[model samples]
Target: MASRDDALRALEDRDWSGAEVDTSPSRPAMVVQSIRLPEDLARWVEDEAARQGTNPSVVIRGLVERAARPAGRTDVVTVRRTELELALHQAVERAIEPAA
Candidate 1:
């Protein structure tokens, strides 16, 4: 098995083709441990992702990203209830409409 540094170097080489690399300081990789969910919970996650037209891994990643976001981050915005309702209505309409 390749070492972590070797893997990252390979990725960097593939991403950068002779471009001057940034030597700026960067944080070390934080290992995220994975867990095996119970069968029922795993099924629910998959169902929820499918219902939202996304993959389970994407749903999981989004949840993690949301949780990890720093407090008072001005970059994050909240959706109004009315906007959510309108979006839901549009989605339903699109779903029922026949393809041209």
Candidate 2:
């Protein structure tokens, strides 16, 4: 993984030239951890990534971020099994709609 400074500098160079850049000191680095998922869950992550035009790592990261967000945060998500099942069913409809 790239160092935080390198990532920040790359972002600054590519996007923040005219804007005020935060020259503040960097925070402590994030810890890296490995997880072993059940095969079914791993396959679901890969499938969702394919549907969303992203990679499995991105899907897993987004899940972790949402799960870790503090309570009362406006962006916190609550998912229901029924909602997820409906969404999965709808994905099949969506997949065929464009070709019709």
Candidate 3:
């Protein structure tokens, strides 16, 4: 068995041929959770997930993340419109845009 000093020396002298260091960003750990929703609301979430080409869990997570953010001043909002209306307007504009 090698001593600690000897092991350190061996590692220092070891050749590095094809070692690849990971460079990807670390993600926050997540825990699985369950919640009950009204039938209509659950359907809406599923529909939204389908429209965005994502799973219902992603839709729920986005909604939860948005809700968890700190609230700002309610006096004068930049967009005084419902999210559904804003999405509908954006969809319409995208549909009307000419092809490049």
- TM-score on alpha carbons, each prediction: 0.42, 0.45, 0.48
Segments in model 2 whose C-alpha atoms lie over 4 Å from true places = 1-31, 75-100
lDDT for model 1, please.
0.80
Evaluate residue 3 in candidate 3 and report its C-alpha lDDT on the 0 to 100 scale: 100
> Taking the candidates one at a time, how many backbone clashes does each contain?
0, 0, 0
Candidate 1 lDDT over 1-100, as tens digits, reads: 9999998889877746666978887765666658699999899889978766667886787788789988777694676798678669869987998999
Write out the backbone clash pairs for model 2.
Answer: none
The whole-model C-alpha lDDT of candidate 3 against the native structure comes to 0.81
Using TM-score, give the best candidate's number: 3
Query: Candidate 3, TM-score vs. the true structure?
Result: 0.48
Residue 25 error, candidate 3, Å: 7.0
Residue 5 lDDT (model 3): 98
lDDT of 3 by residue, 62-93 (tens): 88877887787345334336765766776887
Model 2 is weakest, by summed lDDT over 10 consecutive residues, at 12-21
User: Ten residues in a row with the worst lDDT in model 3?
Assistant: 72-81
